[model samples]
Target chain A: MSLQVSKNGDVVVIEVDGQLIVGNRQELKQRVLDEAEGGARKILIDFARAGYIDSSGLGVLVSLAKRMRELGGDLRLANLNDDLQTLFELTKLDSLFQIADTRERALESF
Target chain B: MHAALDIRVPSDVQQIEAIVAQVVRRCREHRFDGRQLSLNVPVALTEALSNAILRGNGDAAGKCVRVRAEVTEMRLVLEVEDEGAGFDLEACTEDPTTPENLEREDGRGLFLMRSLMDRVERFRGDGNVVRLTLNRR
Candidate 1:
């Protein structure tokens, strides 16, 4: 799995490509945390290219949301596939995250 | 059509990605439905293998985890065996969906596997073996 971080004004859009499972979720987490620590207040994760995510990946996203909120910032998710969206709903993580339908909306939500 | 996949590797977290890839490829080749391919197998296999590597094998360098998958006309069966003693599902106290346990990082693997797969069975005799089944009809 790979993570690409780009910026839309003050919002950092992290595009995760490939499967986010136990093996690679930590890298994504570290990158997200680095962006949060580096003073990026509004973080948007674009999962348009990500096909799969396991419990570990879900955990990372949850932790990331909590971390960002603790820093007085917010983390949003964008462009999640149907399966992932279902996963979030099943796990109730959808309630915890501000998931947008598009990157534009995600950025505007901030 | 019928096929089988087998791999035995040392207990390491890094092996999960390759294993998940192989499972995905085989499932696709077997012509699983969208929900089975996009949701069930990925989540179930990753959870089962991660459990085998991290929990069942205790991440021991010398220990090995064996994964075998078979696809036939009836069902898709996956077996993951690790070198540890075993685990008691009844002993697990944490519920991932619980209000207090939702944010905990470590306890959702088993829950995800059970939720995604059609059947999740644990066999304990010589070692720990988790068998996951997904019906294909």
Candidate 2:
């Protein structure tokens, strides 16, 4: 998977492509931490290109959300696919994280 | 008659889902009715493989997880074996419905697997082996 980070004022947008599963968990986690440490509290993760997300991938998101919350910031998701959305809903993570339909919406949410 | 495939890869969590996808496609081609199964085998299998790759191997090179899939009586059975020291399944708290635990992350894989598969069993006595079975309904 490839991750791209862009900053728009106080909101940091992360675009993730390909699959988010066990293998890329660490990389994803580290990147989010870097963003948080760099002083970007509100993060918008774009999963429009993400095809699949497994449990480990969910774990990465949860961990990052916790980290961001502890730092007094927040993490939000955008462009989640139906399958991915089902996984999130089944795991009840849908209620835990703020999900938006577009990058602009997510950015506005923060 | 039944066919089987055995794959062994280093404990790299990144590669787990891809492999699971490959296996699921093959299983589907063999006429496995994935929809009838409670848990999408592809997703559940990926979760098992991820656990083996990430938590079991712990980023150690050379440590590997072995996966095998077989069909019997139109049912699919998947076995994931890891070389790492086994964990206590009973000790793992996997309640996904708990609000406090909901957003914390990192413990939902096992829960999802259990929820999706018809059968989920862990052999923690020796090497870690997670067995998942789904009947083509």
Candidate 3:
């Protein structure tokens, strides 16, 4: 998977393309942590083009969310497809993440 | 009729992509559509394969993970074996959904494999072998 980062005022939006699974979960984690370390308080992960995400992917997101909160930053998700949403719901992660329907809303959330 | 695919790879995390891609492609060829094609097939196969590489084989350089898949009209069956000590599925006790365990990253693969696939079985006569079965319908 490839991640592209862009800034929208104080919020940094990371657009992820391709699959987020065990093989590439570290890349996403590192990229997001880098942004957090760089002092981005509000982060948005745009999953518009993400085709697949496994348990490892979910674990990565959970770790990111926890780390961001510890650093006084936050991470939000946007553009989750049905399957992605279902996975979150089934795993009870839907409550842990602040999900937005669009990038604009996610950016506006913080 | 059954169409089979076989793969053997060193116990490396990098090899997971190719195996997952092949599983997705073959399942698609077997006419899995919609959510089954996109989420169920890829996610389950990836988790199973990742377990074999990372946990089962311990990422040993010379060790290998063997994967065999049989795709048919009724079901898709996959077997993943690793050249390491058997994995103790009973040892995994963390509940991924709980508030405390939600932030932990180490124990969710088995939960997902069981959740996404129709059946997940572990055998240890020769080596650690995990068999995953998913219904096409």
Candidate 4:
């Protein structure tokens, strides 16, 4: 998967493209952690282009959300497709994180 | 006559998915009227592949997973072989469809494979060979 990070004031938006499977887990985790540590607490992860995500990828997201919470910030997800939404619901992570319909909504909430 | 394609990769999940997609496409191109069968074999093979790549020979040098697809008049057979220490398939038995196990992150791959494919067979004697078959009726 390819990731692009953009900064909008204090909020950091990450756009993930392609499959978020086990191979791309480490890089994805590192990117989120780095941005969180860099003082971009309110994070928006846009998953419009993400095709699939397995358990490993979900684990990384859970860990990042926990880390961001510990840092007095939050991680929000936007543009999640039906499959990913089902996945999150199945994993009970949908209730754990703030989800929005659009990037603007996610940023505005921060 | 049946056709086959052999794919060898460094156990990367993305590459594995790509290979699975290719196998599915090939089945479609061959005019197999089994969309569900195509989805089943690939999904199951992917789970087996992930186990080999992430937990098996991922840390070892020059380790890879080999996937082979064979199409026949009666069925579609996919064999995913990994170069890792094979484990007993009989030991793992967590059902993925169970409501209690849905939230857990691990132990779902094998279950999904068994549920989706018509036949699921594991061969630890041959370096972790997982054969999935879908019969076209």
lDDT of each: 0.85, 0.79, 0.85, 0.74
Per-residue alpha-carbon lDDT of model 4 for B56-93, expressed as tens digits? 77655577887778976677788778877777778887
Q: How does model 2 fare in lDDT? A: 0.79
**Model 1 residue B23 lDDT score:** 82
TM-scores vs. true structure, each candidate: 0.94, 0.82, 0.94, 0.76
Second chain alone, TM-score for each candidate: 0.89, 0.83, 0.90, 0.82
Worst 10 residues of 3 chain B by lDDT: B1-10
Count of clashing residue pairs in every prediction: 0, 4, 0, 0
**Lowest summed lDDT window (length 10), candidate 2 chain B:** B30-39
Question: What value does the lDDT take at residue B90 in candidate 4?
Answer: 81
Off by over 4 Å in 4: B1-3, B8-14, B27-44, B71-76, B94-108, B111-120, B133-137
Give candidate 4's error at residue A22 in angstroms. 1.6
Q: A84, model 1: CA deviation in Å?
A: 0.4
* Stretches of model 3 off by over 4 angstroms after superposition: B1-3, B90-93
Candidate 1 lDDT for residue A4: 88
What lDDT tens digits, residue by residue, belong to model 1 across residues B17-116? 7887788788778788878888888888989988888888887789889888998656789989998888886676566887887777667888878788
Q: What local lDDT score does residue A35 receive in model 3, on the 0 to 100 scale?
A: 84
TM-score of 3: 0.94
**Candidate 4: residue pairs that collide:** none
